[model samples]
Each structure stands twice: as structure tokens, then as C-alpha cells.
Target: MATVRTLRISLVCLFCLMFIAGFAYRSLRMTLHSASSGFYLLHSAPHNNSSPASMELELQDLMKVIEWPEPPGPIDYNFSTSPFKTEFHMPFPRATYYVGEYVEFLITARDHHGRLKTYGGDYFQAKLHSPKLKAGVTGSVTDHRNGTYTASFLLLWPGQVEISIRLVHSSEAIAILKDKRETRPDKVYFYGFFDGTNETMECNVELAGPDICKYLDAQTGESWFCKKPKQIPCNAYKGHSAGQSQDILTQKEASFLNKSVKEKLISSKVGTFMVSPKNNTNDRGICSSGLPNPNPSGFYYQDFWQSRVCRNRAFPTPSNVTKCLSGKIIYMFGDSTTYQWWNFLLDLIPSLQRQELHMKYPAPQLAIDPENEFAVQWQAHQRPLTMKYSDKEELHYIANELDRIGGAKEGLVIVINCMAHFISLPIRFYIKRLRSIRESVLRLIKRSPLAKVSIKSGNTGYLYIHGSDWLSLQLDTVMRAMFSGLPVTILDAWQMTSCHYEPHHLHPGPVIVKNEIDLMLSFICPK
Candidate 1:
């Protein structure tokens, strides 16, 4: 009896310890999920040596690469970088340039007071383009950290090309954008509608307190919160919609964002010069996955993107596009940019039919080419989206959707674009979200090594206070860093949009989209 009582007591003590351990683990997971962008959760498996601790360590490494340099002085319009005062000129001017040669420009940043800047933090976009030919290529900008920079362009086309440098943002303006973006999660608001009532309340990713209603995704641990409706219960929340954009910049800060300054082209002394092709035949290797992105990745000549990274194959005709897509299962997930790819295909392929699921605006869509035996689907990635109104049920996290596919099958092509909507959020949130997607991608690849995964880099667009090209560049930097070493194809839309002669747009026009899709197809049909 004494031995039995002792054994029973010992077993009870062991069970209590196990319960306490489990509770601690659960609390830690919840805290991480709620604090960041819900990248890790209590229920998700630890695939391939990836644990919470391991992920945190990896994040720290990425943080170092994306760390932005802070401006040295206080906000003063007189001290801010000025596009009108700034000037760029060819450091080594030549009467004629040959293909495969580089054209370098010396950029001198100046303040509104016409004084040469003594420090560097200003954001400038540089490109070489031929307006008549509709040809352009992004130039590489090298900051000297001493108010001077270098814009280097690789001459890929044989024609007259002009150099352009645009001041996207002054260092002072960027300082304001950075401060508000990190601390002001409520700057961009959303609305929550209550069922059976006309009442709508403000909703957001960071709303907290006892009087708010929270909607949580159990699988992913993602949460959305809204101010509780006075007349309806929290469960009555029926839909989500984008609300007004509240400007946080003061009048003085707005001055830095003036039309004359923001995205304004700087004075250039260089004129358009002719470029002669290389003496020998230039043959680029065939397009394939895992190829490193070349500087200025590709250039436009005759309105076609000539990729330095791959020997791009064109699907110029509708029949050509259909043939390449046949027998393939394509899944595109993210914002409107990814949707544009699907739309482009639908318009291009005459035989492709849209399978109407009665979806709403910015809805998940399905299209099939029955004769070709191929299917394509596009879904908007979850919250931080800026749609005027979208059903909550339609928004799904990219990582969750990737997992549902459960180990990629043959002929599967997954293209992901998640950077545009994430620019307004904190950098850590973007990092965590990308980390989760990276893990999911790894799982898919591990199961089947042949899966073709492509990540579309965010493009240059939006010169406003809310979604600036600088912000897009910042997140794009993090995204590339996070996915480094992975066997994925980066679509290089950043370079594609930056170099294009067309006006900067969040959703680039058909000409640019055509190049983007063609580049994607090159990877799929490299032969």
C-alpha cells in the first residue's frame, strides 16, 4: 500500500510538470504571433530544423542587411535635397558608345539653397532610355555617403539613349516616412461592417483593448481587430473594407513632398548618344531557374525586354502563350500585380474560359484552358491589402494556401507577390510574413524538388506620402534578402518598372506587364 501511494503521487507530480511546460510553450507562441505578423504559431510543425528560436536568429541576420541609415540633421526645407538644384553629367562623355560598355554619370546632390549636400541619404532613381524606341534600362546608383553618387548604366541597345535622374524623396522626407511607418500602424485605416445592421466601425491590424472585437485565424494565428459596434455583438462582423488614408505629415513635412521636389527629374547635362553593338555576336544562355540577377537585369529594345539573366523566349502570339501554358497548373497569389498576370493570360488565350465562381472585386478567380489541359488561379494575399471593399472570407494568407497544396506536384507553378501592400507596415512584420512563406516554400520544395516557384519583386510606383517607391524599394530589399539561396526565380519587376519609359504606376501598364509575363514564361519554358 505504501509503494502504491508513492508511485501514484509521483505520477501526479509528473503530469503537473508536463502541463506547466505545455502552458509556457503556448504562451510564448501566442506572444510571438500577436506581436509580429503571425509567422510562427503553436500548431505549425517545425520543418527542417526551423523552430521559433531558429527563426528569430535568421530574422536578426536579415535585419542587418535592411537597416536604413538615419539622416544626420533636423528637418529643414532649405537643407533638403532639391531636384532642381541637383545635377548629373556623364563623367566620361564620348561622342559614341558601343554595346557591352558602361556609361557612368557623376551625380551631385544639392539642397534647395543651392548648396552641395555634405551627406547622403537622398533617394534618386536613374535610368537610360530611348524615347523613340521605347527602350530603357535601370542604372545602378552608388552613394558615396558624401553628398555625391554614381549612376552607372550598361549599354545594351544600339541607339541614342538619354540619361535621367529623378529625386523620389529627400532624406528629410524619408525620415518622416520612416518614423510614421514604424510607430503609426493606425495611419491607414479599414472598416468592419456588422451583420443585419447599417453600422460600420473602424478596423485595423493593431487595434487593442477590452472594447474591441478580434477575428483570429486559428491555423495561422493572424488577427484582425475592430472597435466594437454599440448595437451589435462582435460576432456580427460581416465584412472588411479599406477606409480613408490619414495623413500624418505636418505642413513642414508636406513641403518636402511638394510636386516640384517629389519624383521630379533632376537637370542632366548629358545628351542622347548613339551606341554601337559589340563587334562579335552576343548570345545569352537560355532562361532557367536559380539564375543570379544581373545588374540592370535586362534592357528594352524594340519594346521587348532583352534579359541579361536569361535568353528570354517570347510568347508574342496568343497561340504561342497557350502552347507554353498547356499541361501546367499555375497558382498566383498576392496583390493586383500578380492578378495582372492572370488577366493577361485570359486576354491572350482565346480558348481560355473564365470559371465564374460569383467572386467579388479583388476576388479569388479561376480560369481554365480545357483544350490545353491547363488551369490558373489567382488569390489576394491576406490583410494589409488596400481594396476599397473585399470579403473577409476571400482574403487568405499565402503561407496557409501554400501549405494546403501539400507538397508540390509536377507541372505546378507558383508565383508570389507580397511586397506592395506590406510597405506601410513595420519592417519586422514584413520580415516575419516573408519568413513564414519561405518556410512553406521550403516544405514544398523538399517534398518535390521539381516545383517551379517564382517570386515577383515589387515595382517602382506611387510617389505619394503613403506608398512611395522608396518604401517599396526598402521592402523589396528585405524580400530579396529573405529569399536568398532559395531555388526560386525572382521576376525582377523592380528593374523592369524602373527602367521603363512609361510613367511610374502601382499597376504597370500592358507594355511593362507583357515583359514581366514574358520573363516568367522564359523560366517556365526555357528550352
Candidate 2:
């Protein structure tokens, strides 16, 4: 009985030892496997069945994954049966992505065959539809370089988008490529304010070029490039090169002497000039010439004398005039003669008002007041105002400046006058420049959400006495036609100065200046 009991105890002890050994062996094996492999087993099954080839195959399958969601019904249609597939590559791949976001089911298709038809040059139509928005179409293609038919679409709102590309080949065989892409909610970019008061507002559109840098260096003005030279300067002497007189005038001695003489002459005649007084001899009209003659009361002398006299005494106190242009910028672009008109306007206004000045070449006297509500700037090149080169260059500069101002939330009021300087050239050239200026202003207005344009008609007839009547008639015709269908508001200085002529020249005396200012005031500030 004792021997049998001992044998039972030994059998039990042996079984216990085998169980411990088995557990140790299993733990060792697991440690070894973990060291050799790069996976850990937690609550799920171990992933040790994958091979490199299998991984590659999985990636390929992922690339072939259809962008669309699973169809409602199963179908046996094969992609191989499709006639053609259209694809596009974005030159800037990163542009497809925004920071801190991900897009799912982004589809990019390519045609195995490179033959596709196009219309209107190389433009192709791209249609995009979103689940929550109206369908949109690309208006035109920038280029169809080689066989690549590329188009860009912007996802402005978060939703599912369906992309459809159609290659129109002749009247038939319109190839269609369709894909649906899911875009994650992305922050929509809103540029400057679009309020009617702000000038920088623009409708949302897909941009193709480089992002415009808004913060331009203010210290460095526009980089100068040599434009086509002008044949004749606008106010150059008959024999001298067109713009050469500017260089001559720039000399210290000449400029100082000329300015001194002008100031002295103007100051001496300030109080002596008569206002727009009625003629004593006849009731023909008020004269602007101020000189009493045999026909002092006649229409010619009376009107001339009155215009000059009124212009001298018509200075308006700032308090009396409504400050309609207290914070707006008004640009006056033209030649030196235009500068004179601006100066005259400034002088007629109260000195307490703020103003700023800016000048470009040839029109060195240009000035403006940044702080003034009614600031004016003049831009003129040395070339003859009639020359296409001058107008083109001036327009380019104006466009650039307008772009800059448009970026800011400021409205622009432009007044342009150029015909007086260009009168020497063929009428056609003048018309061309005028048209170019008009087009440039129109472009500026289109770009700027808040802009008003006004044009001062040519004052050509006022400068030549003997030919005044004929010149006036011609100017009247041109002014009437030039401003006919346009938005430009005309300021007629020619008729205002019609009767007032310098003793030997056509230059309007002080009286005409007053008449011109009154006309401007009436238009600029009604009532």
C-alpha cells in the first residue's frame, strides 16, 4: 500500500515539470519571433502573411480604385469597352492641396491614345458638377501643348464633385470621361472685402498665373524700361527735338528766371483785372478781355473781360463749399498745360485745404495731395501727346498705378485732357491716343469696384487768336463725338474762354480761368 502511494506522487510531480517546461519553451519562441519580426500581437491577429509582391499589388489596386462611391446596383460593364479616357496634369501639383487637410477620391485620368480634337484654337471644354451646387464649365483652355489636354478646376465649396471631360472630335465622336471626387471641407479663401466702397473686390475665379504679391516695396517705384522713343516732344520748339526743351528748361538759371518772370507778371495783374462785369456800350454780353475798346460792350470783349475778372476774385472759402471730395483721390493726367489748369483750380480754392503732388517725366510740374479729399495727379511723357508711343507708355503707367490703387480700398476719379498738345499732329493720331486713353480708363474702371471717370475736352481753340473760330468749331465737333456714348463727363473750357484772348495770343486771361472753375464746380458739385 505504501509503495503504490509513492508511485502516484512521482507521476504527479513529473506531469507538473512537463507543463512548466512547455510554458518556458513557448515564451522563448514568442520572444525570438518578436525580435525577428516587426509586429506585436495584442488583441488582434498578427499580420505576418504579407510579402513584397503582395504589397505592390495592393498599391496598384489602390491606384485603380474608382473615385465614385459604390453604385446602387451591381453591373458587369468593363472599363476596357470605353472609347477613350481624358486626363489632365496640374503643373503645380501642390496647388491641389491646402495646408492641414486631406482630399479623398481625387481622380486623375489619362488617354492611352494621344489624339483629341479641339475648337477655337486649342481650347477644350471641361464640365464640373457638385452635388450641392450648380454645374460649372471651364470657358477656355490656356494652352494645348503637345497632346496633353489640360484644364484646371477649383473646388470652392466642400462637397462631392463630378468631373466630366469631353473631347469634341468633328461633329461626331464626342469622347466623354467622367469621374466623381470627394473633397474634404476646406477653408475657403476670401480676399479683400467686396463691399461697394472697397476697390479691391473681385469675383471668385480660378487663377492660372503666379500669385500676385500684394505687398510691393513702396520705396522702389516701378522698374524703368526704355519704351519706344518719341519723335517730338509735346511742347517742344518747332526746330528742337520734341522733349529736348524740357532738358533746357531744367537748367537752374533758365528755370529760375522763367518761374520768376511768370510769378511777377501774374502777381502784378491780380487786383487790376476786372471781374465779369457787363458791357456799358451795348447789351451784347459781359467781356472777359477787361480792356475798354470801341466795342467794349460787344459780345467778344465783354465776355472775355468778365471771364478773367471773375476767375481772379472767385476764391472759395473751404467752409462755404461742401466737402464732397474730402477723402477721395482725383487724378488729372495730361501735359504741362494740364498742370496749369490744375494749379489754377488749386489757387481758386481756399489755402487751408490739404493737397498732395506727384510728377512724371516731361510733365514735371504734376502734383497731388495724398491727404486731400480732392487730390489730382498728372502723367505725361516728353513725346508729342499725339504720338501713339506717348499714349501707349502713359497708358501702361496709368494701368500699373490703377492696379496698385485698386488693390487698396480707394475710389478713383480721373479727369483726362490731352488734345491741346496733340493738335499739331494729324487728327487721326489724336483720335487714336484719345481712344487709347478711353480704353485704359475703361479697363481701370472695370478693375476697380468704385471708380468715376470724367474727361475735360481739348482746349485747343483758346490758344490761337486768328484761327480761334475755326478751331473752336472743330473742337466742338470732336468733343461732342468723343464723349457721345461714353461715361465721361465733359468740362468745356474752350467755350468759357472763347472771348478772352491774350493781347497778341490766344491764351485766356484770368477771367477765363474763373469761368472754367465755375463750370467744373457745377459739374463736380451740383447745387
Candidate 3:
């Protein structure tokens, strides 16, 4: 009995030692993981297929693992993807490619020293355009994770099509963009004016100081911080405006970001080719919600966007648009890019006239066609909207405005876009705002199942430290991921703008905007 008891005690001691060792190992591993992970809390949760809360927890866990491209070594200009050194050519090089066929090309990334890069994360925009025809289309780029990329463009028209590749950002520049974006929200600052006083303070999406005033939105849990003024109270904050942008890029970093290297065209020996005649046949069903987003979602042929996700229709005249939007209450909520849609519609339709709201610029604009029995309104989303001084009261949270609808009415059309103004901030901040909006969207859908809602993806623009295309791509990824599996339409303006022959603009030209509006209207009146 004595021997047995001694053996049992020894076994128990060994078990305890093993348990303690395992616990310590796990703790250390988690510490290292948290230190290296992206901007989100790390915690484990059980997967429960029955609950959305469980799904969201899982989604966040997935987001925690979504790593942006990082440089393998210290930032060096010699290691960055170089437009002058990188080369692209047709992998097959056929004599004549027919329309409706894919024109595939291979790109090999090289550094400034003309040395072959071993990894791939370079932002490249590939397009086949005919300047004479005013035709252009974005190519779908596939990275092989081994420094090689494939850009495939669908030949939509028969003509002399030239291939142009622009190195939008080097992998090193993207690393810099990721670092500055997650760490330095103050790069692009805002101005906060105190009421009845000549006092102003620098404001931002994230700031920390003993002299800072923090404003937290209870509904969305979104926080904004501003440097405290000398004499004015935090409550005295009245008007808001955009402030000067402080350069955060170092001289070494700026070398990779100069205009000469940034968005610069690479010289290619693969000259223009003639496309043979072929019918552009698409059997895509009528435009509706929940269409699968295809690669190279659509292309511009003769300056008009053709969506492959759905059979997009065109509202050619004022009567066509009026007929489609008749008996609808359309609410456009977003930054200036989305506002362009409202502006475009108002300009196109003579019956829709602007109402005298007597409000400030960038305020809630309403246009009504009483005879047509329809109304269109555009309101900018809440804070972080950087514009010339505007009234603080004018900015409203999109989720709040969405909730105020109290169950949408029939023929209700809602377009939501809040990504551009958010690129400067951390991805976590954007996620929080999206969660609030998602919840409101759920409730809105629950109340009115027939309500038409569409989310316009971010456009391609901004190539600096504060707002880089790479940074926007990160947020855009999160937005698409968060809103996935929901009943909403995504106007893929990202691909539209990226592949266009025209220059990249935050506010894309009329052709792109018209295409976006057409896609939205196609969903509204899918005949």
C-alpha cells in the first residue's frame, strides 16, 4: 500500500508539472502573437453556426490574421519594386487576338538594381485601351506569390488596343503606407473650431495626450480625439474643417514615393495589337442584389462600363431615369464620391430640381420631382469627413440616419459608401463603424425585406503616406469581408476606376460615375 501511494503521488506531481508547462507555453505564444498581430483584440471563441455573434467573433478572428504586405528586411530603396526595372510581356504573343478573348501577359518584378524580386506585393494597374475609340478596361491581376504576376484583359472591342501598365506602388512603399497608416493617424489632421471663440485645435481619428479631448460615439463606439484648446472647453466645439497634412514619410521613404517612381509607366516592347471582330456575348441575368462579383467586374467599351456581375441596363434619357426612380425615396449617404451620383442624376433629369435647404456646403442635399412622385437626397457620413469648414451639425452617422427610417418604405433605395474618408485611420476604427452600420442594416432588412440597399466600394486614388491605394485596398477588403453573406449590392467601383484608361481620381470622371449610377439603377429597375 505504501508503494502504491508513493507511485500515485509521483504521477500526480508529473501531471501538474506538465499542465503548468503547457500553460506557460501557451501564454508566451499568445503574447508573441498579440505583439505581431494586426489592429484588433485577440481572443478565442467557440464556433457556433447558429448565432451571428459567433460568426462575427469568427470573422474578427479571421481579420486578426489578415496580414498586410510587409518588407522582409529594413526599408531600402534598392529593394523596392521599380517601374523602370520591372518588365511585362505577352506570355503567348499571338498575331491577332479576337474580341471577347482574354489578352494575358506576364509581369516580372525587379528592384532598382535590376535584381529579380523573390516576393510579390506590387500594386500594378493593367489596362487595354484605344485612345481613338475612348475605350478602356481594367485587367485582372493575379500574383503568383513568387514575384511574378499575370494580368488578363478581356478584349471587348475590335481595334488597335495598347497595353499600359503603371506601377502604382512598390512593395516597399506599401510597407511604409501600412506602418504610417496604422501608427500615424495625425498625418492628416482636421481643424476643430470652438463656438464663439477664435480658438482652434488639431483633431484626428486617433490621438493620445493629457491635453486631448476625446469624443466617443455611444452608438458606434467610434472615438475622435482633438488637442485641447487653451481657453475653450471641449463642449464648445462647433464647426469642423480640414487642416494641413503633415508629411510623415522620411527622406529615404520619400524616394520610393516620388511622382517619378509612383504611378509611373513601365516601358514595354509589347506594342499595340489589332483585335479581330467577335461578339461580346454575356448571358448574365438582370441586375439584382447578391450577384457574385467577378474578376475585372466590368470594362469600359466606348466609354461606357459593362458589368459582368449582372446584366446592367442603361438609363439613356431623363424619362428612362424618371421611370425607373419613380415612386422611390432614394437616400445617398457617403463622401463626395457617392455625392457625385446624386449630382449626376440631378443634372441628367430635368424634372428633379434641387430644394432650397438653406444649409451649408456638403450638407444634406434634397432633390424632388413632385410630379414624378420621387425624391432623391444625399447626405455625407459622420466625422473624419475632411472638407473646407462645414457645420458640425450637418454630419450625421450613417447608421443613425439609417435607423431613423423606422422600417423603410416601398421602392426605397439606399446607397451607402464610407470608405474613402476612412483610409487615413486604422482598420479597427473602420471595422467598428461598419459593425454599427451592419447591425442597423440587419434591423432595417428585418423590418423591410424589400428595401433596396447597395454599398459602393472605394475608388482608386491617393498615392501618399496618409492615403495610399494600398491602404484603401486594405479597408476595402475589410468592408467587403464584413458585409459578406448579407443581402446587399456592392457597386464595384474599385475595379472600374483601377482599370480605366483615364487618370486615377478620387472623384472619378463622369463616365465612371455614370456607370456606377447605371449599375445602381439597373438593380432598381431590373427589367
Q: Which digits, one per residue and each the tens of the lDDT, describe model 2 over residues 336-359?
A: 555666676566555323222222
lDDT of each: 0.79, 0.34, 0.77
Mind sharing the TM-score for model 2?
0.36
TM-score, per-candidate, Cα-based? 0.88, 0.36, 0.85
- Could you give the candidate ranking by TM-score, starting with the highest? 1, 3, 2
Q: Which pairs of residues collide in candidate 3?
A: 138-499
Model 2: how far is 94 from its true place, Å?
A: 87
Error of 3 at 172 (Å): 1.0
Which ranking of candidates, highest lDDT first? 1, 3, 2
TM-score of 1: 0.88
Q: Which portions of model 2 show Cα errors greater than 4 Å?
A: 1-315, 318-322, 349-361, 364-374, 385-411, 460-476, 500-506
Query: Which candidate tops TM-score?
Result: 1
- What lDDT score is found at residue 469 in candidate 1? 90
lDDT of 3 by residue, 1-527 (tens): 66754644453344334334533553453344332111111123311212658646855765775564556777578878889999998879887789878879999999989999998778888888888887888787788878889988888888898998888888888878777777887788899887667877888887776777776554555566778777666756665788878887879988887878888888779988899998666688988787778776887777778888888888778899888987677889999888888889899988888877677568778777765667787888988877778665566678866765646446778899988888887677788778778878777888888999999999998654466777787888888877877899988999888877667888888877888888899999999
